[model samples]
Target chain A: MVYAYLSILGMALILGVMGHRHTEVNHATVLHRAWRQLAPLLIRLPIALIAASFVGELIPQALFGEWLGERSGLSGVVLASVLGGILPGGPTVTFPLILVLERAGVGIPQLIALLTGWSCFAVHRVLAYELPTLGWSFVWRRWLVSMILGPLSGALAIAWL
Target chain B: MTVFFLLLGAAAGALLAERQGLEAVTGALLSAGELIALVIPLVIIAIVMAAYAQALLPREIVERWLGRDAGWRGLFIAIGAGAVTPGGPFMAFPLVVGLRAVGASLPICITYLTAWSVLGIQRILIWELPFFGVDFVVLRLVISLPLPLIAGITAQWLGEPGRH
Candidate 1:
């Protein structure tokens, strides 16, 4: 967590320098663009955090503790991967939900699997973006290759650790 | 739309906490405050990093290094560049298509997309670190390091229709 904060500070410093340079060249266009993107995150994230906190409080931790724990093992990985692919929304929603699960005792392997699945094989991204832009063939080929990635990663983590 | 749902969930959460009792309310608020504190700065920095990354790479450079015959060197280059390139599918997919048109191989293309998805530096610094912490992030990255290259090799061996 300290590393995260320090890294952010470092990035902010770089952004400051970069933003100033870009301002001289582009008259603050890039700065404005970055802010336009960040504004939504600033507003939505706090609300999501609040909801996620309550969700942590409300959901019985025993449920996740069992379902996503080491006891669940390979099956847990499969389930987490499948869940990750189906999860809706962007980072705000996904991260907070992950937070809830993590606090509720979902292990690192399962979380890793979840994130892998979300990134590599989320059906939403395929349908909404990849299919339309990259076409069916590219999507199909990639999707086929990706089907095992999440579970594979999870299993690997388990074996390695 | 997501924001709308978040608002609704927040409202429901607050109400549910109220019903649960003062202790629940206090607990939720404290945790939420802590998370918000942790997340906000990270989000701000991440947004800036994404913008910077978007500006850093030139399309020409990406195209030159990721061509069909570039081999393992091409694969490594694709992974590094893809990991750092910011924005969503809107930016990435089109860039991949453009690269493919200019003689980038199917395997390299697959490698690029997979690397971007799995190891996206911007997303990790912003979301994963803040939410999952450094430990989980590090482990995931370590385990994931081999995947894009593996996928690329697999694609090469398969030699599908899109092959050059």
Candidate 2:
């Protein structure tokens, strides 16, 4: 965690210097834009985290293991992808749940599929952000092209590992 | 959205409290605090970096490279940019809108989004590496590497049938 923070901070410092040198936008404007973006996320961060914790606790580890364990095979991967797409919230919520699921004996392939599904077919993100901003045409096009990614990747993981 | 999360949290907390005790709720809060402490700094820096990158990026260059005529090169550029670009949908989607306005092709845009979603370096570094460890991350990355290109080619085929 510390390493991640330091590396990203270093990147930010470099980008800041570059932006100052090249962009017409001044430091004040860049900071203002970042602040505008960060404020709302900061507000929601704790609430989401708390919710994730409680929700994680509610999901029994054994139950998760039974359904998504290594022996569960292709059906487990498919189920995981469907659950991943519908899983609410963002990384804050999803990653922690993943940790829990991992501890519960879920297989590597299933987890990979779950993560892919969450990233690609995130129903919440699509409805709340993509549909409104990019419109249905773009959404449908992207969906048509990438819909199989989750399961396909999961199957690949299974084959490779 | 915050409100919805809040209600969900409260409801979940209440259920846990009933099953376990108030201690369960308090434990959840404490753990949440720890997670926030670890992640907040990373998120803040990532957002700042994204903002600066947005400001510094040469719009004309991006447009020229990602335009309709750029073909395979455009797809590659989109994938690279998407992998490096940080933040959530708010940042990515707006950038896509801007790029599209400047003649970035649909296929390139799709590729960019797919790369961003599946292979964002920042996300892998901060979230996946920490949570899933090295082996899992490496395996997932290797297996999923070709996804954006595949999606991009499919989009190209569907969006421009005559050209293909």
Candidate 3:
């Protein structure tokens, strides 16, 4: 956690300096924008963390392992992909839940599938953002082309790793 | 959504308390508190960094590069832009709309969205690297590297027959 914090802080400082040099906006503007973005996330974060904890307690580790462990194979990957696609909210919610799943014994391959599915088949993102802006035809085209990626990556991971 | 999550947490806490006693609920709360304490600082830094990066990025150049038709080169440009573009769907989807309005092809747009979704550097640096660690990030990147290109190519092929 400390490593993550310090490295990111370093990057933030560099970016901050660069922005100050290049952009017309001052540090105050940048800080204000960040705070605006952070506000909703701040609300969501604690709730997500608390929910993840309680839900993690509810999930039986043995059952989760049986369903999505290293030995669970293709079925596990597919199942994980579906779950990932259905996962609601942003990284704040998703990552914590993923951490919980990781601790509960989901295999690396399944995790890959899960993350890929979340990225490619983000149903909420599609409905709320993509569909309205890009239209139905474009969304369908993108979905058709990208749908196989998650399972394909997972299968490769299962084979190689 | 916050309300939904809060209700869910409350229900789960109730169930846990009922089944395993108040001690288990307290334990869960403590665990949640510990995780929050560990992660909140990182989240704050990440948001601020993202804001700065977003401000510094050259938006006009991105739109100009994406609006051109350079075939494979255009696809690569799309990939690069998508990976670097920050914020969420609100940011990305509107950018795609703008690019499309300026004559970007469907395949390039698809590729850009795919890259943004799977390989975004912002998400990797802020979320994945911190939560999953370096090895997992690297492994996932290696395995998923071909996805945006594949999506682009497939979209191009599908569109080829319909081109007038």
User: Using lDDT as the measure, which candidate wins?
Assistant: 3
Q: Which ten residues in a row have the lowest lDDT in candidate 2 chain A?
A: A1-10
Task: Give one digit per residue, the lDDT tens place, for model 1 in A1-161.
Answer: 99988986787677667655763434255567678889987778888888888877887888888999767899999999999988876777788888888888988889889988888886767788777767877777787788788999999999978
Runs of candidate 3 exceeding 4 Å displacement: B160-164
Who wins the TM-score comparison? 3
Query: Per-residue alpha-carbon lDDT of model 3 for B25-73, expressed as tens digits?
Result: 9999998998787777777888898888888875777888888575788
Model 3: clashing residue pairs? none
Write the candidate numbers in order of decreasing DockQ.
Answer: 3, 2, 1
Residue pairs with backbone overlap in model 1: none
Each prediction's TM-score versus the true structure:
0.91, 0.86, 0.94
User: lDDT tens string, model 2, B133-162?
Assistant: 667888999988899998888887777321
Model 2, A1-161: lDDT tens digits are: 55666677788889888777774968889889889988987878778778878887888878877799887788999998887878876776678677767766799999999999899887878888888878887888888887788888889988997
Per-model DockQ: 0.57, 0.62, 0.67
State the C-alpha lDDT per candidate: 0.81, 0.81, 0.85
Docking class of 1: medium
Interface C-alpha RMSD per candidate, 1 decimal: 2.7, 3.5, 2.4
lDDT of 3 by residue, A42-92 (tens): 888889889988988988999999999988999999998888988877787
